[model samples]
Target: MHLNNDHLISLAETFKLLGDPTRLAILVACLEQEKTVGQIVSDTGASQSLVSHHLRLLRGARLIQPRRDGRHIYYHAHDQHIRCTLQDMIEHIQEEER
Candidate 1:
């Protein structure tokens, strides 16, 4: 498939967003289930503010989806595409560790 300039730019931006460890951790935290910001903070051992900041960026990138239930917001991977991509990456890292 031929990627035009716009497609290349969009892909680059998405990679840039994913390049952040905090953001990647946030996404990984939601791989199996949706999580609140506090849950992500606990899982990632990151500050609430930092997780929230990355959440906003991930949401903007459409890598995650957020739903509001009362005062709490739950976030999860936006689609199977993200889940599969993350899964593949995890496997790659595990392979490297061997």
Candidate 2:
């Protein structure tokens, strides 16, 4: 896929968002199950406000999506693409460790 300047810039932005450890933890926490802000905080050991902030940024990037139920919002990866991409990247790193 040929990425133009605009596309490259957007891709860079997405990587920047994913570069933060806290944000990565938040995403990993919600990978297998949709999690509320409280659950994310517990899983990531980040403050609730911090988790919310990262959640907003991730939602904006479309890397994570939200579903509302009553007064609670559940966050999770929108589809298999992110999961598969992460799994592939993990394997790549593991192979490098050999």
Write out the backbone clash pairs for model 2. none
Q: On residues 1-98, what C-alpha lDDT tens digit does candidate 2 reach at each position?
A: 89899999998998899899999899888888999999999999999899999999999998898999999999998689987887787789899889
Error of 1 at 36 (Å): 0.4
What's the TM-score of each model vs. the native? 0.95, 0.90
- C-alpha-based local distance difference test score of model 1: 0.95
Q: Which ten residues in a row have the lowest lDDT in candidate 1?
A: 50-59
Off by over 4 Å in 2: 96-98
lDDT values, one for every candidate: 0.95, 0.90
Q: Pairing residues by index, what is the TM-score of model 1?
A: 0.95
lDDT of 1 by residue, 17-79 (tens): 999988999999999999999999999999999998899899999999999999999999999
